[model samples]
Target: MEQTLQTSKMVTEKASPLSRRVTWYIFGVMFSINLLNYLDRYIFSSIANTVAKELHFGLDGIGFIASAFLIVYTVFTLPLGFLADNLSKKRMIAFCTILWSISTVFSALANNFLSLFCTRMLLGIGEAGYYPAGTALLSQHFPSSQWGKVLSWWNVGTTVGLMTGFILGGMIVSTFPHGWRLAFLFSSIPGLLLGFLVWKFPTKDTETQKVSLNRQLLKQASIETIKRIHQLLHIRSFVMLTAMQVFAFFFLGVTVTFMPTYLQQKDAFHLDAGTAGLYAGLMVVVAGVAGTVLGGILADSWQKRFAGAHILICGAGFLLGALFFAIAMLSSSFLLFSIFLFLTLFCVNLYNGPAAAATQQIVSPAMRSSALALSLVLAHFFGDAFAPSIIGIVTKYIDPTHGQHFILNSAGQDLRLSLLAFCPIALFIAGSLGIWGTRFAAVDQENVALPAN
Candidate 1:
């Protein structure tokens, strides 16, 4: 009888080789899609100088364009999250990919600042659905035990995409006439094809989990959505985690939007767009990859011995990242600046996987997408949406006044000072919140029903 039970357990525990291969294939496709998502979003930053000059945009105008995307992205995510929870996530992802890709193509045709701004807003609508749907889909496939590791690898797509965007945009703008437009046009192609691939691919979990709908059921689902949101907010750990993300993402917004320009204008560097892009991309990818992977592994391993190991790891990363970033901003030597910047990125990224997985662990399966969407809305709206503009405003105001107008300086000092003032403050807040969150992590996880493998 004991042998029979042991044999049954072994058979149930082991996944078939073919099943494992298919699982990895799904991960690969999703990773590629995520890469494209960020690449399209960040390419503008890579060629900000050219775009600003050609479009006759001042510093404030440039920041406004970036904020427009985040504003729209944040607003649309809630409804998309609702759809993801109730409908087929795979189909939603496919549709969003196609929509964003088309918008990206249209950006190439934009003739003026207004046209380009409109295109970016449309692009935000298309891309807002991807994260909530993608993360929910991942939750369906992997068990709680492996969530950190799986998500860490998935998050790597972000760094890779950012790197590609910076490098590709820089290369095109530097090498070709009307290169910024061409860059946008070229970036749209892969996403178009990838959208079809996502639609064609068989996602077994999505198929199996389809919910039947009627008027009564629709009403119930809507009610449940509201109740779940209230419940999620009530969870102390979840709220704390969200708070931590808010501050962390604020720094992220400032860095990604302005770092390339900063590096170019710095007295010690004075690098062109191409060189700045190459170096920034390389630094982000190398440090980001290492931090993401190591953070996940350490979080997972440490969780065995500590109740809130993931939160602890995240807190340390934020604190250390801020310290390094401060040093980088203060340094006069280019090499010293580069080294510290790499460390800053590495530490900042350490929370990506663990924080995401923690949210999933605390929420019920039905509310997973909504929770993530809400998190995104809060993080972007309060954190990143205004950061670029704030920095830009600070830069403009600090510049010497010429006649009646405050002239914008290209010396990089104003921008650097703005970043130094904001980034460290935000990072410190995030780290403190992360540490506070550790106290409630175990209790929150216990309240939720663990999803089956």
Candidate 2:
């Protein structure tokens, strides 16, 4: 039976073609799953203040909880990445979705910080396998000719899920008396349901040959995995890009984490916890959608003419996003701030699709999951995971007089302003990395075309 399943996946991989409609369907389904994954994470951000207050968590404590998710995410990512290389991508994804959903549902039942932290950590473990497996599945399902475009659209799910989570989670929490717990519960349902769909979905032909799961991963990860990651790390361009991305994401995490509180404190926008969450969620949705669509289109067009076009475009987008955000911070008008926020999100998202495609093209198929996993490992550990928590601590420093008193109101702006410094620096570094990627584009092309393990 296992051998038959393996044979089925190989046939699917070889037969995957560049059909337009099928490509779109693949994008839609994958995007939906991606969205759900993020929605699960963002629920906490939308209610950071409420949770912190209720749990009596200080800045450091809150940061630790946020980072706890990543600690587990990082731990599981590489193992799962290797698993994707050896196992059925479809089954792996289905299992992961269910695991995470169960964990998320339990989040609402936690009574203390430790329990909540452990639940989130478990949630991270389930989520860890998602990206590498998802990416490998997409690559196998689509022809190489269409990878750039399909991956971009697939990447769009991140924005969509985040936006939905923010908007839905925020509104629910705001409107209902017990909205916070409800928010976590509501998000879990869709994910749990999606696991069934994922199972039903056809497996890629290349994925038919499932490897023995009993095989230990750390020992099995190829020399190529080590060499490729080493090469990626050593590349001056990638290093700069990673550094920039870390900072950019750090700023994003901090902002989103405290956005509701920022508005309440800075703009005097009095909202129920849910309303504030909805507003912040909307910000991510609008910005994420616009940025992804436009960025994907631009990256696809540029890739045809220039080897490093995607990276260049990514750099430019980040720079534009940073400028808009910086300008928005300077202005006090709510209307102006909204426009800038939208613009900033748009620019920031431009990198998502292109980065994923580029990463795939740069590494070997056998090593693809690990390469991507390593990236996520680095990004989560260094970027989004601790960003919100860091900003929370920073806010405390900015107004030590208030200590924890100002966490809910009037003090978040100081943190926002201080965080402004992170964006431009990140953009500059990302742009420099794009330039570096151009030099090795040919080398990557040579390595990527090698046959799968």
Candidate 3:
């Protein structure tokens, strides 16, 4: 079995058509675009506190607003994924980028909660198209052996964009009047240009197999779609990996929504928004980048010795990450919190690359986008989509009067308590799921059916 597997890998490598330079160029463009995706998506989260003050909404309101975007984001992903599978991926990506950038620009025009919520929901619609298309497009470019590394490299865009949103939002909001508006305005430009690049991406290579829209293809039945989804769910490893995604997304949603505010509160760091953002953003870049890159390398390298290495790495990261996350949230001292936060971000981010690679590996080339889209639908909807609101409710109602005398508001302390409650427990559950999934990975891989390359 081992010899046959080795031979198959060797053949796939030789069959790959992407030259190193072309491959890297595609990666660079996709990575940059992906960075922009998260940058615009999280800018709202980065400046949630300011928005709440200006709009006269409480933290709970902020939670609902964040959830609004995610609900829209989750709802549209599968439809967009179907389009991604049937249409030219670059074109879909290009259009999605432009759509989201325009939505970000509109975000700058909002003065009230309703307007902001509407703009964010639109942003969700625009941003939803990129992942399914980009992931599938890139997966088709590399052999299976390279998916973990390349996807990890691409996934770093999330950490970079998220960090940039916080840092940029921080620097601008502190230095100037109406900085949040400017932040949104500034973020929209790069995507417009990147969308152009995606649209014009060289199609000379046959390997860049552009799935074009045809009459019959357009009329493809819903039953076929259902069948595709059914196949993916039946794969035990895939099911577990997706089940784990929900918890991880929930942890991220809560953190992104409230961490800056948490750090800025008097009882905590007592820093200005800029300083708080700087600290949060720095942690994201430093620790997040480290986790993602190293995780990818470890998964790829370890796979040589272990068939379940990708899932194993994900499980270990999530478990270790949860421990650090709990410590970071519990620490009273700045030094201790910072140290544990770095550790938490590193371990929490470790699953990005390996998880992406694993999902792709188990599905066929044709269903890759839709399968991942299905996972996103469930993960984001149940995970981050309601996290802010759930946390918000907890903060507002659950022992709402506990810390009234402290420098923090009732909600602020509630936010801390909420994070303490949700983040670590979710991470632990996610880790446990990943460990359980590892056992099925090898069996699933051996059984996966793929069309001839």
Q: lDDT for every model? A: 0.83, 0.71, 0.83
lDDT, candidate 1, 1-453, per-residue tens: 343233222222122234677778888999999999999999999888778778877566668888889899999998788778878888889999999999999999988889989999999999999999999887777766788898999999998999999999988998998899999998999998889988876664442246766887679767876886788799888889888988998999989988887777734367788888898889989999999999999998877666578888898899999899999999988889988999999999999899888788777777789899988888889989888888878867765641112123254777778889999989999999999899887766656633355
Candidate 2 on 1-453: residue-level lDDT in tens? 343233222322242665767656666677888989998977787766566667777555666777788778878897787767777787889899999999989998887889989999999999999998898888876765556677777777777777677677667766776677888898898887788888777435363346564435446556545766786676544554555566566666666666665665643455666667667777777778777777777876766656566666677777787788888776677788788878888887888877777676666566667667877778777877776666666667777574544654556556566567565555555555555556655444544454556
Q: Which stretches of candidate 3 lie over 4 Å from their true place?
A: 1-18, 204-221, 399-410, 449-453
Off by over 4 Å in 2: 1-26, 204-209, 215-218, 222-228, 231-244, 266-271, 446-453
lDDT score of residue 299 within candidate 2: 72
Alpha-carbon RMSD to native, per candidate: 4.6, 6.2, 2.7
For each candidate, give its TM-score against the true structure: 0.92, 0.88, 0.93
Q: Candidate 1, clashing residue pairs?
A: none
User: Model 3, range 242-351, lDDT digits (tens) per residue?
Assistant: 89999989998889888887877666677777887888898999999999999999998887766678888888898998999889878888899999999999998999
Task: Output the number of the TM-score-best candidate.
Answer: 3
